[model samples]
Target chain A: MREPTVRTQKIKKDTTRTRLIFFGILALILIICSVFCEYLTPYDPYLQDLKNAKAPPSLSHLFGTDRYGRDMLSRVIVGSKASIFSTLLLVGLVTVLGTMAGVFGGWHGKRIDTVLMRISDMFLAFPGLVFAMAVAGVLGGGLQNAIIALMAISWPKYARIARSETLVQKEAPYLKAARLSGSGTLKIVFKHILPNIIGPILVTSMLDIGTMMMELAGLSFLGLGAKPPTAEWGSRMSDARSLLSSAPWVTLSPGVAIFISVMIFNLLGDTIRDYADPKSRGR
Target chain B: MDQPALKVSHLTKVFTRKGQPDFTAVDHVSFSIQAGECAGLIGESGSGKTTVVNMITRLLDPTGGSIVLNGEDITRMRGKELRKVYARMQMVFQTPAESFDPRCTLGDGIGESLRNNGRSRRETRDEVARLMEVCGLSADFASRYPHQVSGGECQRAAIARALAIKPRLLICDEATSSLDVTIQKEIIALLNKLRREKDSDLSILFICHDIALVQQFCNRVLVLYKGKIVEQGEVDAVIRNPQDPYTRRLIDSIL
Candidate 1:
């Protein structure tokens, strides 16, 4: 092994430490919002205290009362549990499903490839969110149904990316060696092909997570997602629209939550991608 | 007097381009290498020598004719039968660095054939170590990746990979063409050593455009011109007394 320079090592260590602290803070926030959200909610999120409706921020109503007099801070905090975890689930499931289909089609590269790619193209030809909405509209409102709609359209993007990457990997000379090694195509695809393309797949997965969250929130905000009276971030913001002048806190709190969460996921993705790239890591 | 190690009977390859006339890369080329003979196939860039090797190794299917190894026809073998052919014949590519799957250690890359052949980990490790040593690579080179090695070393590793299967016929597709002249001479010597160390029955189909190297290394030579064999005989006989006009042209061009 070559001797490592102290200066370069220290720089690397500092960058790692910084990323660790950043993710640590985000993780801590997530845990607190998911676990202690109800305790933090001064008022029951579902209960409508019409008598105190449209009240301004005060000790009794920390983020001020919504039109239905629910605490705005409580609603946004409570909604975080649903949005955060479901986004994780959506990202995880879609990546597995998409990467599998894409790798399979790309490796096979004939009739199977043609059929799989054509199907993805058929779906992609329609605008992504519009198709998700159409599916959600048919399934009716709820987190699960909206998720299904989003997932149906979302997996194809990964499938296309993975498929193109697999095509490039297939041409690598190692594959010819693998064939001469007496290994079959399936073995070559799984053992050799999959690992090479994993980096880009992960980068794509990270980029998708934030956008998917926004799509989910947009669905709920339009009343096509979590249904009536569910304190989803989007649903809460929808209810707060009329009271913008009186209690801007009502919509603004959830809006800011949505924006921050999306930004965090995007930044997390960008930083991780840059870390994986050698040229970027040198700095 | 001995049975041919490899026989290609009127092999042909016609590439069909859309909306254009079909292109014939190698047309009606027939030759046979007797057991223990080293033959070189020499040609210019598009003379279709690589196409011939690809057809013989089953990398590309011939539009016509048969490829027989040790009297077993494998012209149209697929799946299991094709794999069996791989055990009988292996090819070393032109560029060694590009030959390996860069993701794996040299040990893993060289040991892959044995692994596919169902050799256990201990056996594979021993075999990889031994092959690396034979290829003139140190034991440490086994654990290193392709990028960490020099071009000559990479070619040696590639040769080791081809040798792991102990195939009867080794096909060299301009295997040393990418290296400098000194390394090329060294690689040619190593290949000669491999052939001599094995049974006298071991055969090599050395493919190159380098006529001088082919004249020195190969016992017999076939001069291909425009997908057709123009002249072939004992290397000394053909070089001293060329019959075909194209063969004369090829020899005259060497400088």
Candidate 2:
């Protein structure tokens, strides 16, 4: 214990607090903006005024207007609600489904582990976005279809992660002692294994929410997501791609919104991973 | 003669490898402890002592063997049956620091066995407090997590947890090896006190490489080498005359 430098390094990393409050603040603002967009805006996000169409960033309009004369700022703020809500739902579903599958697979190895893991491997074999696009295409166009497609492809990542983590967790000394104390598989998996791996799982979920947001936006851009007049950021940006030379704010505003939101989630993930680790305290 | 508390006969474990011959970790090992007796299984690292303990505790299913605890065969027990056998016999792990869940307080860790045994929450707390005292720990320390306490205190908590359901056989798998010399002696003293309490007929399968410690603690001793029981007898007799060369070496290496 005197010269175990590796142990010291690990402890230092676990306890170190990398100032993540900045990321938290950024994420919180996005959440607040999404949740309270209706009350915070001066203009209706969907009110298309052809007379003011393609207006540049102005004092009255703020982020100017899109091709349809809808306020870009208001649209970006309001459209986020759907993306955030869907991301939360997708994340929650993925975590529950994946962890349950993984815990079961890892606990009852042999045939069960092989079967569960192989199915996930099949899901993982496809390039994630391409597989999702294919599913969405087959299911026809709509936000609901796109979400279903995204969920179908996304779950395997969590399942694989949970399974591997559970395999390691089940071997921990406490769990073995729990077994020696007459605890059943359910008790050991939930009480012992799940708590230990929850930090990593949370980190995974947070980072992936950013990915899910981007995916939802991508589907929208391709006309297979939020229908017309919806004013989603990705579709909003796509509509302005042809008018790039004239009104850049139409595309740039939504692009910036997407970038900031995604960065906030990613940073939030790093902060959580650092803070949740017993060795790492936050700055 | 009184029936033995534990009977492990022809216990064997073979580690099969991919595209290679299997490694026999333990071969035809057999031993038994009489009720209220303290039996020490002495062996060096890789000598299959831990494997034997793992099999007996049912953590690792043996390749072939029968383990009978107080007249019940637990060798092939599965699911609910195996879980039932757990309360009757418990294993104290080598590393006390790792014996408890990091998320759980010492009180929760100790009270888990009682809860499994269907003791009410209030009753479990009372029993855990009493067990903590029996293991020489203060009641207030029960609220602390494993990492919050010292190694010696954690080991005492581990002992209390093992004894929570009042198991007849306690499989101590090099339990005191991870503690400091002072703490090691303290743990040994605690076990001795438990044995002398008269009402608790606790049988211990104490696994250790420390021949001198076994001589002080165990009534009977079994020496293992390369997965075989090379020598075994009454602890005093084996120490006074270690017939096997490996046993002599083990005794000589004792610091």
Candidate 3:
């Protein structure tokens, strides 16, 4: 076996305290941004001031004003709520549906596995964005519809990963021992296989959160997500496109918000992935 | 005098990997154990020793065979019937670390077998403690998870879990191979103690690669080579006066 590296030691120490603090702070910020959206914004994001349009950054409006004189800071904060909420909802739906489908497909192999995997392959064949767009087009544009569209395209990834994990877990000696101990199918699947594979599932779900957020933003940018005045990052970017050359702050603020949010989620996901791995834990 | 503890006749297992030709893992293997007798299945890896044990425990359905345990034909059993058969037979797997749910503590893992067999939590807690003591583990260790304990302790916990339901047939599939030699001796001693104390026709199928270990523990020994039984007889007779070339080779390797 390879000796533990300094990097591994740092990760172990990092996981003990800093990781939890990071998540706590991120969650707290997002919650406060969501719950106090109105209070956090100095001006109504939709209210336009033609005279104040394209104003440079100042103490009154820290991020300055957009082409429509909408406060960039206000729009960014309010927009985060829509993106965060929709992504969280999409992830929740996918986790539940994907895990169930995976457990079933993995536990009952042969026909069930074959059919479920075929369906997953079909979904995988379509480019995720194209698939989401098609679904959104069919369902029509709205926050809820975009979430539903994202879920339809995203669940297959979880299903495939979950099924593979479950299949491997099912063959493990402990699972076989559980079966020989007279554990029923339900008990074996839920108690033995599910618990064993949960580490991977959790890590994947965390990573998927970032992907789902980006997808939601993309849909919003394409006008297939939340409608105007909804204060979503994608829609804000869409609204500011015409003023890209003039009032760049409108696009810059929400664009920066999207980037930071996605980066934070990705970082958190990577941390979780590293922590959940047994090899990494040993270090 | 009661029905033989286990009757395995013509047990054969074939594995046909995808895109590969069919191959026999256990070829027409047959054996019978009297009540309370310890039978050792000795073989090298890929010799199908574990497969036979798996088949007997109903973990793997045999391609061709009949396993009659306590006069019940478990070979044809399915679902509920198989589960009922399982209640009477338990297995201690190799790699005790992998034998447990890492998320659960040792007590939980042991208690799980009892729970599966319909033992209540209140009833099982005391029994679990008692079983842990019988397996030479302290009751306090029950609170620790598998990872928190040594490999030997984990194996003991596994043995205790196997014995939880008071199984008629206990299959140890290289159960002690992953442990140190001293720990292996201790585990072997524990098995012998449990066998004598239970005195309830508790048959054991001790599977391992070490012929010497089996000779010390089991009454009867079956030597397997390449999925076929090359030699088998009373432990002393086979160990002292070998029969097949393969058996002699194995003995030579061990000595």
lDDT of 3: 0.86
Which ranges in model 1 have alpha carbons more than 4 Å from their true place? A1-74, A228-230, A279-283
Worst ten-residue run, lDDT, model 2 chain A? A7-16
* Top of the candidates by DockQ: 2
Please give, for residues A194-253, the per-residue lDDT of candidate 1 as tens digits. 888888889888878789889999988887788667778887788778878778988888
How do the residues A1-283 of candidate 2 rate in per-residue lDDT, one tens digit apiece?
A: 5776564334444322435777877788888878888897788888879999999998998888988898888888887887676677778888888878887888889999999889988999999889888999999987788888898898887787888888887788998888877888778878888998777888889878788889988988887777767767777778789988899998899889888888789878877877767555543
| The candidate that achieves the highest TM-score relative to the unseen native structure | 2
Candidate 1 positional error at A212, Å: 1.1
- Candidate 3 stretches greater than 4 Å from native: A1-16, A36-75, A277-282, B230-232, B239-245, B248-255
Q: Which ten residues in a row have the lowest lDDT in candidate 1 chain A?
A: A8-17
Distance (Å) between predicted and true CA of A234, model 2? 0.9
lDDT of 2 by residue, B85-186 (tens): 888898888999899999999999999988987989999999999999999999998899998999999999999999998899998999999999999999
Q: List the residue pairs that clash in candidate 2.
A: A14-A279, A14-A280, A15-A279, A15-A280, A15-A281, A16-A280, A16-A281, A17-A281, A17-A282, A17-A283
For every model in order, what is the number of clashing pairs? 0, 10, 1
True contacts kept of each: 0.55, 0.68, 0.68
lDDT of 3 by residue, A133-243 (tens): 999999999999999988888888889878999989888778877777788898887877788877888888988888888889999999999998788998888978998
Models 1 onward score TM values of 0.89, 0.91, 0.88
